[model samples]
Target: DGVNYCTISLNQHIPQYCGSCWAHGATSALADRIKIARGAKGADVQLSVQHMLNCGNVGSCHGGTVDGPYQWIYKLGKRTGSGISYFTSQPYLACSSESRDGICKNADTSCKAENIARTCSTFGEPCVGLSEYPNATISDYGSIMGKNAMMKEIYNRGPISCGIDANPLLKYTTGVIRGWSLMQDHVVSVVGWGTDPEEGLYWIVRNSWGEYWGENGYVRVKSGALALERSCTWAVPDTYTAPEKNNEIHCYEGGENCKVSAKDESTAAAPATRKPELWKRDEVERRGFQWRGNSSTPSSHELLFTPSNGFPETFSWCDKDGKSYCTVSVNQHIPQYCGSCWAQGSMSALADRIKIARKAEGIDIQLSVQHLMNCGTAGTCQGGEPNAAYQWLKEISDKTGSGISYTTGQPYLACSKDSDAGFCKGVDFSCTAENVQRTCATFGKKCVGMAKYPNATVAKYGSIQGKDAMMKEIFNRGPIACNVDAVPILNYTGGIVTAKSKDTDHSISVVGWGTDDKLGFYWQVRNSWGEYWGEQGYFRVQSGALALEQDSCIWATPKDFTAPERVNLLHCYEDGSNCAAAVSATELVVCVIERPFAGSPACLRSPASGSSGMIGSMFQAGWGVCLERSVARTWESFKKPENHANNWEEAVSFWAVSFAHELAHFESPLHDRQHGRAMEMSQRAVLPGLARVLSKPWGSAVGSQNVVHRKWTLQGSGGNLLG
Candidate 1:
């Protein structure tokens, strides 16, 4: 009873306009019922509206009765118990017999064999009909009238479709519409109902015009407004063709090299790049990114999850078991308001997802949406698509090993190429190496572009819609970006938002979902409007009220976004030629010495050794010389009471003289000139430090040196006797 079983939302006018609201409304409601019948478990099953348009002879783009699809699908299932195909098999084409728009002008809107269940080739081949396709069956269907009947049907089962007079809803933005009319022209799904103390009773309706219209593609109209309660259609879901594997055929434009079960939107061709654009203050003074409509195709892959204990009644990435797996809230309206809601929403969700991937253990990894605006990969300050941003980042990750840089590398300026709305106007939005990351010396010193920097990439991304679908994604992974009607939310101060949408022109992130004892189900959203506004930069709204559960929802997977190691070590080769090559002096080098050494304690233990202490000399490796181990052996002998030296100072002086003599040879080859210089410096300079002699063996060199008699004080930090 606490579970959500509703499926994703639908838009009939995408990829072009089509007056197929009747089919969309019917299919969506049927899909929701199917999900409910299935116990709200596994992935939500969606009924194909396209299949209804292609085969069901009820209505076309021009419109038809609300019960057409339900009645037709029910009859079709009576034969083999197989009815309409799944949306994955036959996606919405926005085409029908009675209407045409965009690419649909030349589309085949027929009930022909191929049109019934079709497939196109990715390599430019003729379209063909599929003998086998996944479909959902409707066992029973009927019509209902009156307010009480509609509410009971929905509450007992799922959503129901009904015809409504939408003539007065053209300008509807927020709040419950109160007018009533009997002339029906459009159809929509009534998901549920709620009562507003001030506005009285209302219906939570899901429209087919996409999330950009009427309270995020939904409208809360008075119970009897526009004859909405006059009549409604309901369907009982039967057995659906639930295949373990995806067998649908996918093809590129012009069709040919079609592949079976390739419904992944991530693999689709990337959108064409656009040039950077700047807008005037008056042109984009409202919002940076307005609704450009969804250009990306819907993803067919639904994440399959089986929770061991089911989902919690309330869960949030912002507060999961006392730890917040989310980043701090960001303000997109800073400096001034910028219409980059697309960037702000998408980037914030991405950053939160990255935080979730890292287990919120270390420093947070916040992505730069400004980078998207500057590079013109996603969109400009004028407007763009949030879903497209993920695709662009994925493209960058595939081309280069890196994706978008961190916010520290490139902070948000809220300016485009020509926009003058804020102080950041005229700011360089160029896509250069320096623009990506830069470093400068102190004060007025020279500055240079950085070659590398921290970044996060997208592994795969896709779109999903509806309350349950959005909840599953947030619960399984992290947060998600979704379009919402900003009118009611903009003035929101506190409490749950019961007002519906006009146009979902604003974008925000859905962090999680919770059940309000008084308000019922609500979405926990993160806004980019700053913490000073609306409950600390966030607002809770009735789920699906502003079409927040619609197709405008997009999510991405974080790839290669983990934090870097704490310390970076420089590995030196065995030759020791490139010793301490880094610019920083503090760099630690792990030098490996695999070659054999000559002057070892084992060799010196023999009495036949010609030298008392071997001189440090240059090896075959350039820039570095080997210091014989004999100096350490000599120092060990002096430290003990057994060897020669008058007192402690004399004992230290004997060891110091031996160390200086060998250091001199190491600086130059075993030459007398270097030895004389070292001897002079040892006598003149007073070096203060305790040098610990290392007993490790060094290469053999033929030389013997007498210990010089001079008082020397060596006491400091530990150091190697030989270099």
Candidate 2:
């Protein structure tokens, strides 16, 4: 009764801007009502406003009737049983049929199948439409006018969409709008009501603008202001597509693509959702986890196998083959206490799967929980969903062709939206490339963002429950992440935990199951609170203790990962200021030969002149490059007096560019002019600042020609550098 069933915030202006406030308002209200109808369990089901804009006869970016979308969805479900698609299937593109400007100019705003619900193998185009995507159907729709009816509808069901004045809200910021204009133009949803000490009674309203605007994406308006209480709309959500227990719906054909969208429990048989249960966080009870419930009848496969049916009496991925396939134990409380059990648990399970995928052969890879915390849609330090973490991982793999990085690449920094628990006090949680993964400078070099880094990817992932499903997944794959109560195990020393409470507030990975002589059956669970706590960062719980097996447990499959190798790896510039891309096939090995006198051609002399041709000689011996020290010294001597203070640093730059030019030959034909252009472009791509310095003419000190062609020889060392 005390649960907040409202879903996460939404913005109509992401990726691009759209003025579909009517559709956003209507769909959001209906989505909240659907969540309310489903008892707030499982991942929140967000309705797609884009879906409505494409098909809802009511709205566009320009505007439309607030009640029309509800009527349209209700009638669509009544007629065809397919009311609206989910936001996950058809994420917002902020385009509409009415507006042909901006992003909508080339967008497909039609009611085609792909336009309605599409999934892509990558982030870009060439997407296919699922013939049967999950949809939410509405039973009835109606409209009401006046304050009392609006309040009753919201309190009884959920939030209701309402209209409001346009001109006065243009400058509205953080307060209850109170004015005389009854002009109704913009539409918003009224979630609830509150009484301010100064403003008296006000309606808690949500806007289509992003969370950065007004009171966390909400603005309270004075009761009955601007005719906001004059007109309102509400819809009764009837049923939505949901997966059966221990199963998932494939969003695409062949059952090989991403899993279906999050499901709700409500249906024709179970019209009313489960009642809301309440739990709080405290010293003796630290429950911050959630179980995303499932619907539909269990499959025959689910009924065939129970936990003890043909299953081993005891099995553990940790001790399998006398080797621990799991990654090292982690501590979320270090640097500061972070409630990132969700990230730690899921990522650990995924890493263990990766290790198992490799047959526990090579290094036990540890995934970066910090990378997930930095870029994942899953909740943060306060609490979050482990299932959502896997879902987000798969989504990123689809978007960027990669998933989370290793812990060695992006170490843990327990940071999030609210909590600043330790070393993460001033961290940024933006999901940019640099924010996702970046390195700090060393040896006085400026920090450079890594354009390409190694990463692990997800092949498939989904939620599972019940002891049999958990055991089967663990026995087959490796380990799984699940929710726990955490209260009873706070001071646990050893032995099996038999706590009765199932109020899950923490997340931990279940590695395997075991049998105890006196304790009966128990789960071998791994915790993220460092190695010093409770059985060396692990504990055993009686099979179903704290709803360990019943709550949402997550499993992810590792597709492939970049092996950490040094072949063709990026090399640093001579001064360590920037990186020079490895553009050669084989590793470039250079040998430096210092000449005794300047302008002597010491490297080019023949045996006939009483000296062997060192350049010709080294080329015969198969060196990648021959660096003449006299030419380096000549460039140093030719430096301007103004550059004398940084002469040593300039010399380092000169040598780096010289090597860069010779390496450029491997990428192109052995032509001096083409190699020169390739070297110039490579310098600009790798280091723009240094490219500018090398582009300048040396003021007749080195005789007017560019230093690249004047001082540096452009020969391929033995012509083997290309290989």
Candidate 1 lDDT tens digits, 1-723: 434444544546443445777888888888878756655433345566767787788877666787778878878888655688765345466567655443344556677645654443211234445444557777788999999999889989889999898777655655688886968888999998999998789998887653324554568988778899987899987767532233222232212122333333234442232221222234432343333223234442363473788777788887786456666556454323456778888888888888677665543456767678877445676666776677678778989887786654455555564355533343345554435543221122212223345577877788777777787788887898988866555445566888765546667899987899988999888876543345545678887687676545888888775243422111211111122111110000001111113322111111121111221122322212233353444445555554444464555555556545654554556476776755653454212212111111122212222112223232333322232
Worst lDDT run of 10 residues, candidate 2, spans: 582-591
After superposition, the stretches of candidate 1 with alpha carbons farther than 4 Å from their true spots are 98-100, 243-723
The candidate maximizing TM-score is 2
| TM value for model 2 | 0.42
Model 2 Cα shift for residue 265 (angstroms): 32
State the lDDT of candidate 2 residue by residue for 648-687, as single tens digits: 4454355446545653443445586655754563455323
TM-score attained by model 1? 0.40
